[model samples]
Target: MAKVSILYPIFRNQQDVLRDLKTIHNQTEKDVDLLVLDQRSGKNKDSKSRVLQLFPKVNWIEKQFKNIAEMMNFGFSRAASDLLIYMPPNIGLKPNLVQAYSDAFQSSGMPGMIFADYAEVLPDGKIEEKRLRDYDGDITERGNFGYVKGYSLKAAKAVGYYDEQFNRAEEYDFRLKLSEHHDLIRVPDVRYDVFISPEKASEKMSVGASKLFYPGEGK
Candidate 1:
């Protein structure tokens, strides 16, 4: 059995799925189970064949989830690893992403969540590294942590998983909830490179958490 479960939720993003699958396959830590919760009908046989040939070990689970929270909840329920990572299709992880988490969590007595730093993949293929802020009550609450977070399955279950109400801001909401009762840490490591729009990035500054709120839910 794998020691970690990467919950990668996707819609109809086959191309990006292929890329992310390849990235997962390249992780230094091979003891991992990738649970791709795809909320779409199905891909064509040709595309599936091509990708599967490259990484056939994927644990593909097709489901119709309403939002990110629901998709994550489904993955959490079926997690095979003690460590659960919420990895979106758009995110790009380094070769040591899983290995980094494994090493850190094992040494830190397995905190509720171990968050790491990330780099931005610029439009021209340039990489700009962004480190996580030093853990502080005022900093985390006002601002937000970047992408690339390693969640503890035990802690996630205690908080009742994620609230399906928050869509894009699920990470923000989740961290807020986790910080309330768990030991949140800011590890200094560039383990991921998230692709962002040039317009959204402020010159050399990092983009904060995405604001994904439903009509009924206030932001």
Candidate 2:
């Protein structure tokens, strides 16, 4: 079995997905399988074809999804490896990132997730360090490093899978489920640059949490 199975689902973000395709193709560990679920159809067919051309070896599946969570779950269902790593379309992996993940999973012998501190790079090339607790508002009180939203992969059949109901906070929900079964680890490695485009990433802070999450549903 391949050591890792990477699940990356794409919507209209063709350009960013292409960049990630190259990163996966260049991975030092060729023992990884990549499953890309293309979520664009009709007018974007040509662009979708172009994106698939970049990754001929990938297990490509096409279907429109209501949201990111559904698309990711679709990709996860097609995965064949024991370990499933879910990442966004804009994240860039280092050459040894998969190898590192495989090593971590092997050495740890614990069925759980593992993530690292990531460096966020802007389109113009400015860089900033991001952490799991950055947006929590109580940074000093929180640990410096831990599981972020979702960067690790546990046993594919274990911990269930991503909850499709969550448009956002899917990682938060996944961690909650994972905590009940296994330990989560934060590896101190800068393995990838999770690039978030300014327009999509820098949304107004004034946007209410209800808007960001589920609205009109009391917690």
Candidate 3:
């Protein structure tokens, strides 16, 4: 089996999916399993064909999920490796991301979850560094860590997986639960870049904890 499995959720953004796929394809870590969870409907056939033609090694699954939590739960269940990394469709990864995660997982005694700092590509093509704070058990609920994260299958299952009832902030809820039992390790290196449009960048800067956690609620 592969050393780590990447669970990527692909929505309607085909270009983003392809870009992320290319980055994953060029990773320095060779012993990696990639599972593309395509949340598109049957009418959207182009993504499947294009994905297959480009990255044949990717294990693609086309299914309709009720929410992000449900999709992630299903993905974790199907992951071949105990160490699972969650890669969103909108990020650009460094070549060493997988390798870094693998090393951190092993060296840190396979923590419940592992996350690292990331750069953000702004609307004007400028890059901004986002250094996430280390895990604080006392303020876990109020903390807003960046989106990209890695999970341990055993730890996740022990917490009963993600709460599917939440339409948003499912990850935040899961992290809180996971932190209760296992350590949430933070790798200090910048491993990925989040491409942000003008609107998103503005919202990101102006939003408070409520808006940041449960996005699209006030819209």
Best by TM-score: 3
State in Å the error of residue 160, model 1.
0.4
For model 3, residues 1-219, the per-residue Cα lDDT tens digits are 778889888776456677678777786367778998877666457766787898787898888899777888998899988888887765445445556666667666645754443433333433333543323321112233435567888788887898878643444445445554443323232222233333443454455313343322222
lDDT of 3: 0.61
Question: Of 2 and 3, which scores higher on TM-score?
Answer: 3
Error of 2 at 39 (Å): 1.1
Misplaced by over 4 Å in model 1 are 117-146, 167-177, 180-219
Q: Of the candidates shown, which would achieve the greatest lDDT relative to the real structure? A: 3
Q: Name every residue pair that clashes in candidate 2.
A: none
Each prediction's TM-score versus the true structure: 0.63, 0.60, 0.65
20-53, model 1: which lDDT tens digit per residue?
Answer: 6777778646678888776666754554666668
Question: Is 1 or 3 the stronger prediction by TM-score?
Answer: 3
Worst 10 residues of 1 by lDDT: 133-142
Candidate 1 is scored at a TM of 0.63
**Residue range 1-219, candidate 2, lDDT tens digits:** 777777776666456666667766675366777877776665456655776686567777777888666765665666666666665555444344445555655665566544444433233333334543343322112222222222334442366666768643444444444543444333221222222222322241235222333322111
